[model samples]
Target: MSRPNPAVFIAFLVAVIVVLGSVTLAKGGFYLAKHEGDTLHLLQILFRMASGEWPHLDFMTPIGLLAFAPVVLFLNLGLGVGISILLSQVLLAFILLPAVFWAGMSRLPRRAAYLFGLSVLVLVMALVHGETERSVSISMHYNRWAWAVSYVVIVLAVLPPREIRNDVLDGLIIGVGLAFLALCKVTYFAAFLVPVVVGLLANGNTKALRGALASGLAVALIVSVFATLDFWVAYLNDLREVSASTVRPAPGFGLRTIVMAPAYLGASAVALGAIILLRQAGEMTLGLALLLLAPGFIYVTWQNFGNDPQWLMLLAVLLLVPEVRPELRNSFGWPLAQALGVAAAIAIAFAAPSMLNLAYSPFRHLSLDPADYQPILVRNPEHHDLQVREIRANRVDGVVALDVPGSGLEDRVGKAKRDEERVSFQGTPLPYCELQMGIVAWFEAIVTDLEQNGFAEGRRVFVADLFMGHWMFSSLDRLEHGAPWYYGGLPGIDSADYLLVPLCPTSLSVRKDILETIEESGIAVTEVRKAPLYWLYSFDRDG
Candidate 1:
């Protein structure tokens, strides 16, 4: 019965604050600063779910709907979109910061733990606060959560409990993590699952193996029951979107990783090489490093643009953990930790400049007047109708005859605009990027003109543009006659009577083949005409 150290307690609190505070403050750096903001359309999906419209069979998404748990709860609790996101972030930070702190404290001295935690936190923040090609403006939560939980799983697997109660709890934790990965995104699940299973097998821990197997099966069974109720065929079909390589760039490693992560790759290899070639293989550190890095290194090669440094920072820390224990501590491991830390620092330093520029670039934007950054609805009351170019008409006698252009999205939403427009709206809390805003404004004027001149929303309209499709869904979620547009959007474009297609930038961004197919569709084309930015077309199947 020894008394705890007061100094260590104070140090722990300070370390947690420093680590957590920095991450919290950095959220402002990019809470919604990107060109398109956080417009992955999760909130829209949640809105549909709250209103009793399930995706897959109702809508189509390559991303799993199970990822919307936070939003679903928020919607149920009646939280506004803004509040929901903030709460979501706060929840994530609360969970993530402690996990990071514990990992640092587990292996290192108190002072060293603080430093390790700070470094890892910064790396994670920087990774989230910017855009990567692979992430495509995703707020690094997906990557960070998966990494954080995977680290916890690794620690648990390496140090299983002796007590039955503790062992069961650990198994549950791993099970929930795997379940979250399964729902959040499949790639993340695969990333950890492959390495972890191999690591456990290599270690030959049969008890641990059985526990992990049971955990996975339990989660699978639960998900299976729900998916069966939700329509397994639709869920399976929705998965096809990830395989649409032509639509989005393929991620993961190759020769490019060699060029991108030379330092990290070289350093990781050397760490593994030291144990094997130098014959200090008591802890299987190199084997574990190999298992972790085998997939991770390649993934990082193309992860979030180039030089997967920030993520590498956390990965290096995780790989270094097993070697940091008092008994296991060796001549090889300490130096390896320091080397990986240096490598991470060096990598983060290189990648910081571009993202930093983007984050602060809104202030320096030259083209738009300051008024454009103000809330559009304040400037124009009809902005909802204007931005979307159509509204659902209200009819009392079962024949709604109001002249609303599109009825899907609300006027209060700034999410209607294009990516470029949203970027231009930087510093304004709106999600529309610069490109997106410009397109929205243009469509408002153009579509208003055409409708006034006699064009109208027919029984059905095909939104060829992906964002356009989302705009349509944010307003309405009709699935009665839906069919597959592609794989990522609501599956009902071909069933429509009229086709609304934007050319060049918007269409080009959707999918190359889709734009090409629309251009070659040979349907009745009403030339709403073209501009320098894009060509607007309205096609009629009846004609």
Candidate 2:
């Protein structure tokens, strides 16, 4: 064997560095919750899993399991939240880049492949660091990553020259990849399936197709069986508790949001164009389409649900078109086709720079330290100047008793009694419990750390903001016990001994009510605070 081309090796190395560096920079300070509701659910799952409990169905996003389960199980090794998150980030970077590069290099010309790799790097960086609150955190968005991986697999699977000998293996690989992709986000399963089915029929191999179908069915059956078991044993129980709880529904994406729509359209157009170009280009088309569509498709999928079909459309375009193979180029005097190919390449290159720039700039900002600008906690006397101390804490494993203002039949009757004063309605649908855009990750890191440090079974009762309560406790746990404040109304005040609230500007603004609630309940609140900002709360059972 002759020595490998140094240029190709350099290109691959550069691609790897760019992808890894961008991801690392974008995820500066590790992962934090971009959405509170999702974070809470993640934390609940982490807590449950740590305690040998299975996750409920709603919490089991396929992407999350792919990225997080391994990290949570293997790498955590009983470390604090901050350390675990940092390790997870490292692991993600390592796993994501190689997989991405493998997908790109298998098809495109070396230069185009490198560019494609760079584009993926830029796109991920941009999304991770975008100022929009929804961009951060991958816990609930496992489908996005799965789609990226699947796009690559689909392209490669379709690229090889049709051969009976390779058919079974190819079918098996595609089937399995698609199955996993589907598990992560069911919508994506449809996208991959279209191309797989088309390829099987186009190849005219009944045995190969049947084997592929059987493998897919087997995988699906296995997953469904586990899912059903998990649901009956864990999810159903959680669901009932959540349904009966008084916590208001967390906000969702607004109907008028323009971001998801435009992104979808742009992605669809590019993906379709790529597929068309690839298919018309012949044998290399599948690989080319895969390389081109992976980044754009991943980005769009992360932003919205509808773009996966667009990716599939692109894949179809690649499969349906027939062009001269790269190796067969000298056999044909196809001047017009060659010109079209050159033109497509140029168009793709022209569009790439702007897209790369769009993805890279935002991530640069994410790497900055939040503490550089301001202290972690400010104002309130109880939490003032608390940033310097180290608060050794661990995840305390007790069922979080979350209460909403209007939870039960009895509470509704109580609402009628206090309707005249209007004070009863005042606290209904409490605003403080609402999930903030970027706080969930912080809470998760904290809880994860706390539990690993022997706090899993601790008796520290958290009397927290409505947002915190909603996120930290399951609906079932919240409903069965009323709010922590409700427990304060009991004969003894030992139930809600700790009140944890984030020390962001919003939390500082609500300092008065938070403190007043703690004081009126006769509980001594101690802020074990440290920060550029911190989650501030008092932790005393009795005043």
Candidate 3:
């Protein structure tokens, strides 16, 4: 029997995934606080987008508008995060897996179809499985979407299309792909130009290339004009904020991760050598592609070594396995290499559980502590770093604060049981469980104290990290004051009654800046609450 159509087969796979997701979500009660804030943020962005409020003018996402629209559209219509994720998976499955399936099934021997399918699963794991550094749920992280777009772009950039389409379909795909990437941090978007241009020539399909370029430009032009009319100042501010996000404390990521640069450079060089020695167009194109993707990938990794180097790793494995080629499929070497690839993919999938825990342990929204405010003590001489000592001293005075924005009351029925059930934390330790338990317990005690002390209803908090604040207190209004993007000042700072803050050491500078901003606004605030990891300040509206 002939092999199944690659697109048709992957479509079926995606359907299974969606069905599985639905079944898992139907069981309900899975909550990861790591996921909570993110869900709210996406909802916020989608709402804003629906209202014609694009980035810079108000809310923002690092990825381009194209990537967010479909998933956000599904979500804004009152669908749960499960459906959002399912839809995202479907979209990505269609956009990315099809290409991967095509690469294996079209080029390799017919018998190697299983290898292609297994390879795709391994790549998906790399794309969406691992727990992020900040206890973010795998489902919530933007990295998942980023990787989805990046994988397809990386693969397409290096490998020429096997067939150039005469219709607008390929152009639409390419255009939409590039447009989705357009809103990404500028440097990352720019890095793909070489490969895209090279692919244009290598494919020798002027129609597809011209169509792609035109469609991309048209999309960009429209977005730009809209931004210019809507909020050009906000758009300019957004560009500046993107630059500033990279301006954090130096040596942010580990040195071990940093070493990946030279390693990537070496790998690219070897691929280049292979291209020169082999003297084949396909080989040369791949080698060049590897060479081009290496620096960009390495740079981003160095900036933030999150998840899915395994995407590259999986691709590398596929590329390195020689016996999968049609002519060599029957050779003994073919079976051995193919087995090894399958084994490696299995090993990665197997390791994902521990990786999920070791990296970000399970957090459920179980009991909250209704504790009294606890005073903290710190001695400057005892600290090794001046920064730490200063931060501790400031913490004691309640000069800076971090608090989850909202009423400290959401762990009930969970947005109520059914709505909560709509999100499944698959990569989480609970495996589709909802309700954020304490991996490191969230400071719900702090929220409880503020609520008891009269800082509860109709109040807004300037969250140090929306992911944390929104999760703990989804009921409250939020102002994302923790990042530079919100530097322009909270819109209604004077009217707000409380300045909530994260009391953690990492928030010292954020707290300091936000406090300064509030002070400059001339609003009077009295430190009303302090607990481990949080600070609450009540405003004196009369003053």
- Predicted model with the maximum TM-score: 1
lDDT of 1 at 95: 54
After superposing all C-alphas onto the true structure, candidate 2 shows an RMSD in angstroms of 12.3
lDDT per residue as tens, model 1, 194-309: 66566556655555666767877787777668656555577666676546534544433444555446645554554444334222425464355455645554553444333343
RMSD of each: 12.0, 12.3, 14.1
lDDT of each: 0.44, 0.42, 0.44
TM-score for candidate 1, please give it.
Answer: 0.64
lDDT of 2 by residue, 1-543 (tens): 022244674566465556555555443333342333344444444444454533444332223234345436632376533334434444544455654455444434444445545544443333342223333343333543454456445544554332114456545655666665654444456545655565545545455567667777787677558555554444334434443433322123333332246634454455555555554455453545355445544544444532222233324323333445544333344443553455455445434444444354445335544443221122223222211111111211222113344554554555444322111111322223222343423444555544444332433434333333332421112212222111112211244434444333223223334445555766655655433323434455442
TM-score of each: 0.64, 0.51, 0.61
Model 1: CA > 4 A from native: 1-31, 37-43, 95-128, 131-141, 158-165, 203-205, 227-232, 251-281, 300-307, 319-460, 469-490, 507-512, 518-543
Which residue runs of candidate 3 sit more than 4 Å off their true CA positions? 1-53, 60-63, 66-68, 91-136, 161-168, 184-188, 221-236, 246-256, 260-282, 305-308, 317-444, 463-475, 480-495, 502-506, 516-543
Rank the candidate models, highest TM-score first: 1, 3, 2
Separate clash counts for every candidate: 33, 22, 22
Model 3, residue 478: distance off in Å is 3.2
